[model samples]
Target: MRRTHSLRTRLAFGYGLFFAAVLVLMSAGVYWLVRQALLTEVSQELAAAAELIQQDFAASAGPLPGFFSDPDVLLKSLPPRLTELDTPAFYVQVSDLDDQFSIGSASLRGQQLPRTPEDQTAAMGGSTTTRIFPLGRGRVIQLSAPLLAGGAVVGVLQVAQSLRPVDQTLQVLLEGLAITGLIALVAAVRGGVWIVSRSLGPVNEITSTARQIFQAADLARRVPAASAADEIGALADTINAMLERLESLFTAQRRFVADVSHELRTPLTAMRGHLELLQRGVVRDAEDQAEMTADLLREVNRLTRMANDLLLLAQAEVGLQLRCAPVALDDLVLEVVRELRPLGEGVAMRPQLAEQVAISGDRDRIKQALINLVANAIQHSPVDGTVTVALDQDGESAYLRVRDEGQGIAPEDLSHVFERFYRADRARAQRTGGAGLGLAIVQWVAHAHGGEVLVESALGSGAAFIIRLPLSREQETEDRG
Candidate 1:
């Protein structure tokens, strides 16, 4: 198995790493700038001391021969500040061009200041130069300038300063930066972890809720509402909505299974009873045997019809594609009315086709939908009552309405009339009312043609089912033109 870390841990780590990098860069920059500034200050101080010595030499009478002849006079000619024995900051030295003779500051304590060949060459060339040389344990900055007499270079004067103080200052700064950076890094990491944990709290809750729902097999469980209207809240809302849909589907599935079992069991039981009677030689008379056989055949047909309806619904559920073509809506309605008139018994079917409309759809599916709606109306109508079928159109769509003179559906049941295996009159005889998939099939047909089916009814008045379908492409174009 691969190892994994929590989002909070990863986010906090990244945040801390970024902060540390920035902190390190900032500290390094400050250290470099301060080091440069301190070194520059030291160089300027050495240059000033060397300048004062050169000015003193220039002020003296006959500088080159007189100063070279007497080391004491030469040492005394330097700036008083540079010659201080107690001041350990600056060291001043004077040497000839070949470096054969030299005199140093009292602070040097008989030690000679070291001079490099490059500094000697530069000083002989009459160019002032500066260089750093390692001293006893620290370092020193040396500035060498030409000693001139009568506009001629004769020797070199070197001014140097110890770098111990600069080094000590930088070391202290480094230590402070390290300590401060460490403390800030630790605090930033802790604060980042806390912030990340707070941000992901909702995600943790969602995970826990989903886990519980999975283990318990409960689709009705929902993720808790988020406190803030953020992306997490939107996610929770979406998941809750999906759960609600799944729960509805699961409930419907269970109900469908139970309804199918009951519907199948009734016909199967009737057939079995009739078969048992015949086998026992109970119906000996020819007429009685024929009637029993007809009854058995009726039950078998009912079962077959129920099976076919279930098959159609299954096909629709699995996204069955329709063979679409231009269908004459008025003609199809008339055909369905004529075919189901006998099934109406004493109820009359009156098709008030006010308009001849054409639509694009699967003719067979549309015919089946029409038959189901008309038959359903005929079934629910009172004896000798009228079942009115109307065909009409507006600018963009055609409408097929079927109205029955019977007890209207209750307001609560209207919303669910088109659900599979749902019947308002649950106690109605199965043989007469069927398995209640008719309205569902009608709804599927209407939706498949980019249309919708609607119901208008109230208790005890009557019921009207209207299927609205878009006009055929050619008809719509002609009308628009």
Candidate 2:
């Protein structure tokens, strides 16, 4: 089975890995530079030793007749120890032009020094050549110089040094780099884990808060905002905002369920009571039976209307599917006002319509919205109150305003008037209007048409609800079609 790591583990591991990679690269660079510096110092020492040996050979041969002309004399004069003291293990050898070794260090005596093309070239041209190679259990560097007799090369002198000390130094540096890198990697992993854990602390709290909310089924629970203005803080704030919305929705849902049950129960209880009376033969005459039937029909009609309103509200909540077409604003408003004239009773309705003003929207839905507003206005109006339905336009938008001389909405209820099943005066609304879904439907219709509904009202004064919709560009085409 594969193991999956949490976000914290992944973050820390990634950070530590990156840090370790950088440290390894730096350590490798340092090791390379140290190795180069050690090799350079070794080369410089070899050069100095070669120079000293050449000088001594020149000094010892001056009184004698060109001592390099004799390999035996040259061999006897060469010093075994090239440096003063404290120099590392050293080797020296003299070879004739024919590649036969004559003398060497004690460790290399009777052993033939390795010959190379560079040695022949150095003997012929009187130049020095240096090379490095592996020797017994370690490495060595050899510097070859030509011996000269009256400007003619006689033999070659080669000096070599064991690289054991340099090897030992570099080995120590490698060990140090490995040890230090390991320590740094461990420190980086721990530090990364701590920092990551600290940074995600608020996120962990958010997770815990969410879990608690889910377990308790409480939408009101919120995570405390982090103090720092960082991503974590932003996340916390966002979660809190979401929780607030969730709480509002849950509260609204509970209220809606209670309201629907009460509304339905009232009509059902009335129907059941009337049915029981009819079953018990309480209606004795035709007139009494007719009155009972009318009362039952009215209750049934209320139920039917409630069911329709609920269905429409549910559809609007999901999304209102509008049958889009060009609708003449003035004519549609006047038509809705005429249909609601009977419901207005003693209220007066006046139309202030502009000529040829049109919009692109669902005609039926728009008319329904106007009807609801008109009915609401009529219901709230006093006897002989004037209800005005006006249609006008600006350059970009058309407006439909419904004003009524009625006791206007309370300030606190104005914001919630468009919420489903919300009623400022439940008793009055139930008596005269619907199940409190009319205003919500009106708001939905306005929004579906890319318009908005705005209401201005104060208690004991009149109220005006204005529907603002953008004008259609293809009005002429729609009219012609």
Candidate 3:
């Protein structure tokens, strides 16, 4: 959250920071131990000194100045310093309950005990605080006391110890802790930065490579696949796949646009040229004028048909509605055959239809598909070749198979037979005069009604196209509803 960090780097440094914080908390807890230990040693020494004073008073009931006359007895009665305390870091005082001075420690030589309410409030034996009794240079931990006689405090004893050693050790610990925390923080931050940069290297390359692609000039630019099977690699793979689909679509679109423009311009240019020549009196005779006018009219009709086909395709792309009504398949096939009978070799239609078989469809679109398929069969058939129109039901689908005795499509061109503008032999165009969208239109219409066109043929054998459509009253109602 602090800066740009990858998921990997963030997790690494977050754990590191958390680990360091835990150590710091543990170290802070040890500071309380230091305080407790200091107080325990101080209290132990106070208790020992109080015991010795009581013993001496028990041995001899005379009040001191005279009682501690022996220097050895006085030294033993006072609390001793231990090596574990590091130095003589404590103070001691001995006094009577009436504030009469007795003996005191070397550490408390220049300081006086408190005469305030805190000092006068007697403990059972001893009490302590970190409150200061002002000495020459600085402050001290003032330990105060009560000397018991039987069950009552008989005198007061006071001690004030320097706070210097504990404060010095605490200061050193704090400085050390600060330094350690800083080192850990820096290490965590730098490690996060490094991991973030390393993780983003692949993405940066993808961005730069994408920027350099010039697909407008050349329809192929793709991301290089990396070896690592990670999310980044998957992203690159997905992007490259999308680019492949885009390139295919764009190439097809370009070719289609070019072909359309060429087809439209040819007829348009001929019509324009012929009209201009006629207007300028270039054709004087009736015969010449009539021939030119006929050619112009033919071109005009061709242009109009082209425009209509294009509009049909546009409408089909947007999913044109199909009218649903009960139509007899046999009747539909015969009507399409009748319409195209005089067009080619009087191609005799051999009907093999199931009688009055009902099918759900739009009357016009189904009729159009049948007409296109029948016309195609007739156009491609040899003279006297029989074109068979067969209708039957296969399971839930209605089948209409158009089989013609014509030279079959080649193996190489068979797969693309339904493609728009695909001609098996370009040299054969003069005989048919087809624009090549007839089969494509048939396929599209069949598809619109939840059906498909299937072609089965071998070279030199006749071709049969099977159209299967759902034949049900419910299907018809749903399409209409």
- Candidate 2 error regions (>4 Å): 1-16, 43-132, 141-162, 196-205, 355-357, 393-396, 473-481
lDDT of 2 by residue, 1-481 (tens): 9999899999998998899889989989999999889878877877787777767765555445535467677656665444352233777776667774466666664554586987788667977887888877779888888865445566787778888988899899999999989998999899999999999888888999899999999887788899999898999999889999989988999999998998898888888998898999987788988888998998889888888988998988888689998898888877888888988889998999866788888999989889989988998899999999998877678889999999899999999999888888888976863788889889988999899999999999989999998889876454446
- Report the lDDT tens digits of candidate 3 across residue range 1-481: 5768656666666767786787688668777687668756655665565456555544444344543455565445444432122235665666665565556665555656565556656453355333555665665656566655344555565655676765677778777777877787678667766776786778878877777775344449877787799999999999888878889888768877876777777677888898899889888999989999898887777667667766777789898788888788888888877778877665788878765567777988888888888888887788889999999875467889999888888788878888766677665653455566778888888898899999988877889998888877754454456
lDDT tens digits, residue span 1-481, model 1: 9999989989999999999999999999999999999999999988877777777666663544566667776666555555442267778788888888888777777888887888888887888888788877788888888877667777888888899999999999999999999999999999999999998999999999999998999998899989899999999999999999999999989999998998888888888998999999987999989999999888888878888888998998899999999999999989988899888889998999876789899999989998888988887889999999999988699999999999989999998999887888976646484888899999999999999999999888889999999999887887778
Q: Runs in model 3 with CA error above 4 Å?
A: 1-192, 214-217, 269-294, 323-328, 355-360, 473-481
CA RMSD per model (angstroms): 5.5, 5.1, 9.1
Q: How many Å off is the CA of 237 in candidate 1? A: 4.1
How far is 246's C-alpha from truth in model 2 (Å)?
Answer: 2.5
The global C-alpha lDDT for each of the candidates, from Candidate 1 onward, is: 0.87, 0.83, 0.71
Go through the candidates in order and give the clash count of each. 0, 0, 0
- Arranged by lDDT with the best first, the candidates are 1, 2, 3
Q: TM-score: which candidate is best? A: 2
* Residue 33 displacement in candidate 3 (angstroms): 17
TM-score of 2: 0.77
As for candidate 2, its clashing pairs are none
lDDT of 3: 0.71
Worst 10-residue lDDT window, candidate 3: 78-87
